[model samples]
Target chain A: MKLWKKNIWKNTILIVFGIIILLPFFWMFTTSVSDPLKIFSEKLRFFPEEWRWESYREAVSKVPFFLFMWNSFKIAFLVSLGQIITSFFAGYAFARLKFPMRNLIFYIVLGTLMIPGQVTLIPLYSIMAKFNLINTHWSLIIPGLASPFGIFLMRQYFLVFPTELEDAAKIDGCNVPKFLIHVALPSSKSILATLGVLAFIGSWGNFIGPLVFLTDLDKATVPLGLYRFMGSYSTSWPELMAATAISIIPLIVMYIIAQRYIIEAYSFAGVRK
Target chain B: MGKKKWKKSEVMWGYFLIAPAISIIAIFALVPVGYAIYYSFTDYSLFHPPYFIGLENFKELFADEDFWQVVKNTLFYLIGVPVGLFVALFLASLLNDRTLKLAPLYRSIYFVPVILPMISIGAVWIWIFNVKYGLMNHFLGLLGIKPIPWLTSYEWSKIPVIITGIWQGFGGSTIILLAGMQNIPGEVYEAAKLDGAGGMKMFFRITLPLLSQSIVVVTIMSVIASFQIFDLVMVLTGGGPGRSSASIVQFIYEKAFRSFEMGYASAAAALLFVVIFIVSIVQLKISQRITNY
Candidate 1:
């Protein structure tokens, strides 16, 4: 009986702490649906008294939701596709190809990992301005296409892949592209999936790049759209939270769908470093 | 060395495969860095054709008090990175206990903050930290103390931003650390317990030492993230109270975009780059030594 009580107490403590951690998110969702007056009310309630979907409607209607979503989708899709292609080839080159200065080039790319984006921001900005690329989607899309981290991640994943398969493919008279396409890619589906999800999520959530480049309202991405909402309607907590919820919903869904794969691949490879 | 004849087709295909990536990097990353280096040595404004002034920008930067103040603020910001990460690691360790139920639920709850936008959080934080009619003030009111000027006061402004940052980021650190902790061998802990090691003893002796690799990874990621911090500072205080909260990135932003001092901004950015490069190298060296030890 005493042991049972101890277990029960421990379980209760865990549950309470769990609730505490979730309190803000719960409040965000609740406030998004709640009346504006009740949000700031002295009486703190966990649940909304009345569930109103109007706030969500108001949030969507306030901005070009579809256009912004499309902009985000276009940029994110191109970025992910581009990263996958680039990282795969680069990763293969670093892992398999024999060339002079390969290690030197690989290390140079790895060195880019340490340099913070702040260092590159002004230089990139000036270059973009010179091309008259500011306020253009290409400005956002082009820079994101070549990610040093993607190369690093792909390299790490590629290192552990067995070389016997490649050798077999070569013996079968398959060229490097054929070997990569037919054998290597088929085997590395899981890693590719991991990289694809990560790239999409990173591009989708990146705020600073879009903020710097997308000066035109029509070209604004989702995060920037949310920023503009917050600035224009500073008093509308309900609307702002609603907008935040909408913007993050897709990412959260993606996270849930890929959660198992993400954990498996990332923990397997991630902890090794 | 066995000299393998390179197929022209194969080499051409390799180049073709990599062309898109290289061109983008050249246009966006490499060229910008090159121009930034050039501009760092100039007196270029937005209108001017970047006339050569030979180290003038860097020279002026040395005498800029605001620049020094931003450096101090950035150091203050970086201090939270380690403290916050350690706390997160501790939390991850706790949550990783086998006896703990609903681990995924706990994990998701902690990770929620990380998914939310910094701009949105900054908005919420501003309301929370407001001196009058704010939640923080009201909570502090219960203690019978005067309301603190969180964003208005020079001393207190940066700290609240730092605290909010810690809260939002600790969840991610917890998730990554938890992932690391999951890799620890169960028998190692079992062996320690069999040797009459208590909870605290096991944690310090076994859990922490085994978790060094993750700690290093987490430290590097956190430091990089902290150095690039701009949105929260941009939204919350706008580097108020005479630029007390102006971080190096925000300073660069203001100089380049707001003031249109392209050359000066590029110089500042180069300095930021050098600092991050040096710090990251130091981290890598320290991690290497730790792994060796």
Candidate 2:
């Protein structure tokens, strides 16, 4: 009876806070479908008083929404792919290879890991400008290509992989890279997925990269574009919400699909850290 | 990892494998730290040759009221870290309940916001904090409380921003703590239950003591993350009414990009690095004493 009572109390607290956290997502959807004038009514309508779907149409057609989405998709895809491939190779090297000064190199990686990325911002920007890549997508893609954290995650994952497999694969005449591709890669799918999903999620939401490096409106990603959208249509709450909803749909869909990978990633991060 | 001796080809492949990542890190991350340190003492405005100005940038930055306000706002903003962690711990404990069958659904619901772009988050929150037509005010009105300016007033502006941050943030930590909770052996709980330890008692005495390592890790992550609070603040408040809520990063942005004060901004960036380093080291040292993991 006491356990049941405690369970009931726990449920109430969880549900209430869950609703509070979920309110904005619900509100974003509701406001997107609501009538423009009805949003300001005396009655606090939890749902839209009138379902207005044109807000979505207006939101998309008003600006280069798809273009921005494309830019974002490209950046996220490239950044994730780049980070995964490079980190996997480097992680494999650090974990399994025999080389001169391997420990020293790894210590440098660990040191850089502790140094916050913000510390590198100004000089990186100048470097970007020096290379005449300031307004281009390369500025965003290049820096994220070799993630220290991703490398660390991969290294840790690889370090635990059994040596007997490597020894067997070597006896089968497989080269180092070949063994990595054929054996190790398949074995550590979950962590790689985790790293890829994390990088995708991060690159998708990246506002600072676009804000500092790219000034061209057409080159703007979703977050930067949506920010600019807010500036223009500040009065049109429904339209703005519609735009916000549109930008988020793909991510929410991706989340639904890759959420398990995210859980794996979180657990990996927890244990490793 | 066995340190078995390898052939020349394999040894060369080892260096080949690392070259790309190391070179890129050098170009983007490592070299920049050196450049930031060097340029932090120089007066360069992008167009001209940089001349050394010693510690003038740091001295001026220390004396500048705007810089201090940035520091003040950053300190105030860090309040979200602990608050968010507490909320995360509570929610994680709830989710940790074995009897809760709908845990996965609730987990997804809580975590959805963490995955969304901050600008999308900021847009929804801006309207939620709207003085007249906002949902926050609408709920307040239900309780016969009048609407307060959530984003405009000097006194009330950061309130909604902080709440929004806490809402979006706690999910990540909840997931971290949930993982931590799972790693706690069931035998410990079974022993506690035999000793008549109640739910609250178990959480405080058993769970928290075991989960201290995770808590330290989460604390370090949250504090580091809190210092870099940029995108959300930029969208919701733009550091607001009078630059009163501006973050250190935002200060760096304004000084470097807006005002073209490269040297000054680099100094601020250098200080930001040093501050983060010191705080991280302090947390780590403290954590070492408290938790053995």
Candidate 3:
């Protein structure tokens, strides 16, 4: 009986804490669709009493919603594709190729990781200004196309790959890019997915890069787009939350679809370091 | 050394493949770092050409009370790391139970905050933290407590910012720590159970001690992350009623972008680099030492 009680207690505690952790999200969601008057009422219920979801339509029409989403989508997709290609290419060179000064070059690339992004912010802004690229998406996309971390992730994987395959391909007269395209890529699908998903999520939700690089509301990504709405309609909690929900709903859907790869791969590899 | 003849195609392909990545890094990452260091020693407005002043920026930064206040606030923000970790560890321990049938479902719920943009988090939290007619004070009223100022007062502003951050942050750490927990072999628990170790005893003696490496790694990474906090702070309190809640990076942002004081901002950023670099080195050393454990 004591053990049964303890087990019950443990389960109850877990359920309660989970609810507490989820309350803010619940509040955000419930408030988004609730009436504006009820949102301001003294007694705010946890769940919405009515679904006035034109708030979604209202929020969407308030600004360039679709344009913001498109910019976000374009940036995230290009960043993922760009990082994957570049990281794979660089990773193979660092891992498999026996060129002179390979180790030295690899270390040099990795050493740049020590410099925090803040240290580079001022000069990057200046460089972007020099080239008249400050307000352009190219400024955002170019800086993110390659990262030492992504290269390191790929290089680590390729380092332990079977050398016999490489030697076999070499003796078979298989062309270099062809081997990577057919052989290496097929083997690295999961790791590549891990990188792609992470890159996509990071780029989609990014605020600082867009905040610094892009100035126009039309050019803004989703997060800053929502923020721009908030500045104007700070009093309208329902509309703001509705906009907020719209921004993250896509990411949430993707996360659910790929939770298996994400939690397992990311916890061990991508985000931790 | 076995002088195996290198394939002409292989060496040429290597350079060809790496060219794009190398070019991007050279222009964006490498050059920016060099220019930042140079700018730190010179005075340059947005319009004027940079001129050498030789530590003028650094000297002004040391005496600036505003700079120190931001440094103090950023350090204060570090309190969120350990607090968030404790909650995450507790939650992970609960989720560690084998009988928890819906563990994955529950974990996904926890991780939702981590994947959301800071702007979304800020938008939701701002209404919740509202002084009058807010969800927080409404709850306080239900319990017969007075509504306290959450985001307005200089004294109490950091509390709400830290709480929101913890809410967003603890989830990711919980997920990581949960993965760490599973990595421990099942036999250790069995051995402990055979020795008649109680649940509490096993947690302290077996679980925590074994999980210390992961705990340390997560904690150090959290420290590094706390330094770069910007969008969240901007949304939460806008660094507050009078700069009481501004972070180090926010300080840099205001100086560099808002005021266009490139030299002063670079100096502050240089200091930030030193702080993070030191923390990162400690992380590297500690991580290397703990890998075998």
Which one is best on lDDT? 2
lDDT (C-alpha, whole model) for all candidates? 0.77, 0.87, 0.85
lDDT of 2 by residue, A132-209 (tens): 999999999998888888889888888988999999999999898889899998998878888999999999999988
Candidate 1 per-residue C-alpha lDDT over B56-166 given as tens digits, one digit per residue, 9 for 90 to 100: 899999999988888888888987897888778767876786666666767766666665567767766776676764556777787887889999998898987797788
1 or 3: which has the higher DockQ?
3
TM-score of chain A of each: 0.91, 0.95, 0.92
The 10 consecutive residues of candidate 3 chain A with the worst lDDT sum are A264-273
Positional deviation of residue A65's Cα in model 2 after best superposition, in angstroms: 0.7
Count of residue pairs whose backbone atoms collide, per candidate: 0, 0, 0
Stretches off by above 4 angstroms in model 3 are A1-7, A233-235, A270-273, B1-9, B192-196, B287-293
Using Cα atoms with residue i matched to residue i, what is each candidate's TM-score against the true structure? Answer: 0.90, 0.96, 0.94
What are the iRMS values of all candidates?
2.8, 1.4, 2.0
The fnat scores of all predictions, in order, read 0.35, 0.77, 0.67
Put down candidate 1 lDDT per residue, A190-251, tens digits, no spaces.
77788777778777877778888888777888888877777784447777778777887777
Please report, as a residue range, the 10-residue window in candidate 2 chain A with the lowest summed lDDT. Answer: A263-272
> For model 3, how does the per-residue alpha-carbon lDDT over B1-293 read when each residue is reduced to its tens digit?
87767767667877777778888888888999899989999998898989999999999999999999999999999999999999999989988877667777878878878887888888888988888877788888889989889889999888888888888888788888888888789999999999999989999998887787778767877898898888888888889889899999998988888898998899999889888889888877876776666
Tell me, by DockQ, which candidate is best: 2
